[model samples]
Target: MNKKEKSLLAAVVVGVGVAVFKYFTDRPKKQSIKSLFYLNDFSSISKNFSKEEIEREILKIYKEEINLDDKFKAILFLTMIEGIESLEKYNQMAQETLEEYVKQSSKKFLRINKKKKTGRNIYRENFYDLIEATCEPSSLKADIKLGIEECLNGNFKKGQDIFLSSTNSDKNTFVSLVICYFSDELEKLDKSAHKRHVKNALKDDKFLFLKSYIMDKNNMYKEQIDLLNSIEPQNELQENLRLQHLLINLIKTSDIENKNVNLVNEMIESFLSKKHETTNTVLNIIGISIEWSIINENIDFVKKISDMYLQGDIDTYVDCRLYVFTYLIVNFVEKLSEKNKQNFNFMHLNTDKVEILRKGIENNETYYKLYVYLGGETKDISVYKKALDICITKNEFINIMRILLVTETQNKILQSNK
Candidate 1:
């Protein structure tokens, strides 16, 4: 071969080597970014990941120059991470990012609409409405803020008047109106006017649950039942509505032989049978059923169902485990009450059962009621102290104190009478 040809041949070989090296070196980075995209895509269904793991993955991805669409997606995924270890600092950051993105996007949308104004843009209308209707405090007016505080303080009449007087009758105003009506503030207002407001607001599915609640209150049982039945629950809030509907029906049918009991039983079985049912769903069903049984004064049924839940045949989801334990404690107290016993013997429970109750008691808010029941039944002041220590909310602590006082007074009266 000629020397020039040899030099060209070596150059070709070197170029091929560099290309191969680049492909191999960059492949993993590309794959890592691709994997992050997949994680973001399937985040809604990705239940196996811990919150810390998700946070780490999100932080790693955030360092990259992700496209706008994927950035929004990552923000959404971050929102779904449960029990965020940083007390939701990450969630707050995500929310700020989302708000800024929405602001920029809104400006862009307006520019587009102005340039192409053939007619009103429906997308712009809906998107802007959504941004305005979000529960962010920054999106609300001062009057709306005052109205919310008034409603919370039980000044529903004042709150409702303020909410209705606002020129901005967005979704939150409608919600406040419903709250006022439910609180009976509208009794002084014109019934026709209240009905009109509700009718107009009923277009949003967000109000459907409240509408059903109104129907249930007004003895429009069939209408409420139909409304609840029409709803296909896609998330935990909707599932709660479904459970509430069932509970209302159970309450309406006062007959001891009501067929709704069988329906509830079937629902419980169906939910337990489903491997995909969320912990929140399972807990809702169980809690509702327990409340139903209590309403019916069916203590025996409570015992039966509580025992079934505590037997561990069904895998107890972590969030629901405390609830199950609370139910077990309630059942124990009720059984003791039935036998006219003042205190329960811990020796009766197996070691594992005792451990379960102890672990449950360690979870303050989740097992708050259990502490109340235990304190009342055993006349244990220490139990009340434990409950009060973990109680953060003023209303809950006040309620617990009232319970303790009443129980103590009852005990004194009983001892004196004896």
Candidate 2:
């Protein structure tokens, strides 16, 4: 085993040792240590571990938890363990009750939930209890969906059994999706026969991205960046489809902003210097991050954007930068005051496509603003105090202002009391 694996194993031994001591020595002991170990009492198992070793033991417990002998229970355990391991990054809400112990669940994938605390995907008490309970076919359907999502994300082995065990009627699309993701081509069992599968075949972006991922796993960086910039004027086919490769690219490039792209200054200028810039949509959403800002002289850069076409021919514009600049300004700036933040104004900036931009910004701003409001920064109200939630399903993030809203309401209550 590698050094890291060795370290993890060492930790598991120490952790389990302590937990056994605690179970035997602590007062009010309910169950026997042997019984817990046999039954995969991982929560107790976890207390014995430290660091990543906790995750290692969880994986061990997980293997014992699943089996074809008890197909139904196995699928539930697999899905539940997946959520615990991943903290549901690939699949949000996979384990609703696994909050506290998730600190060390999936050592790799990270997810931010409504609580905004970065943690693991532990099943806590829920998954174990569920699997031990009598679950129906429909309940199995939910478990399979979760498993299928994970499988789509490259966890094929566990996902496949979940597919095989779940009732065929409920999991047809998911089964088809899982099948397609693994590139499993069974004999001509009427590929076109499964409507849900066909539908997933038609609309799912994750499935499409998976195919692209497997075929060209290497050198995918540049290709995916090119794809994210290509999101536009796509029919229903594109709408449901995600440029996940691009999304990953964004995540990687995202933190670079705080570090400063000094060497790439010329590239930065060149990006905005395109003739048919396609709304300067060429820029990654990461470029106009919620963190940084430009100077006032550059504030009028929105005005210089006038030399191009905003929406190209769609909206009659001599310069596209006018609309694109305005969109970025509205997003990056926390709040805009008609009086103070006056030099650069974008609301209703376009006579023709103004409404379209307005609505798009509004919807996105609802969630995005919350991000800036919470741990993010924006001096202006444009960046209000809002809490953001991660959308693991869409592989995107959203802000939840409701978190701070309660705080505001509480403030009002205090003021009224005063």
Predicted model with the maximum TM-score:
1
Query: Which residue pairs overlap in candidate 1's backbone?
Result: none
Error of 1 at 235 (Å): 5.7
What are the per-residue Cα lDDT tens digits for candidate 1 across 1-418?
A: 9999999999999999999999988785433433735443343224445566666776666556355445655655556455666647766766665555544433321111112112222222222232233234465568866775564443556766777677755444355335434344333456675565555555545546555655665666777777788888665556655675666575676465477777766665555453333344345456666666666555555555545554452224254344444545455555555463333332223434434444445442334565665665567777776665544223445556555544443343334324
CA-RMSD of model 1: 24.8
The clash count for each model shown is: 0, 22
lDDT for 3 in candidate 2 is 100
Q: How close is candidate 1 to the true structure, as a TM-score?
A: 0.43
Tens-digit lDDT track of model 2 for 234-291? 3322322232234435444645553334323333344346543332222222234212
Please name the candidate that would achieve the greatest lDDT relative to the true structure.
Answer: 1
lDDT of each: 0.52, 0.38
Clashes of 2: 22
Model 2, stretches more than 4 Å misplaced? 1-260, 276-358, 361-418
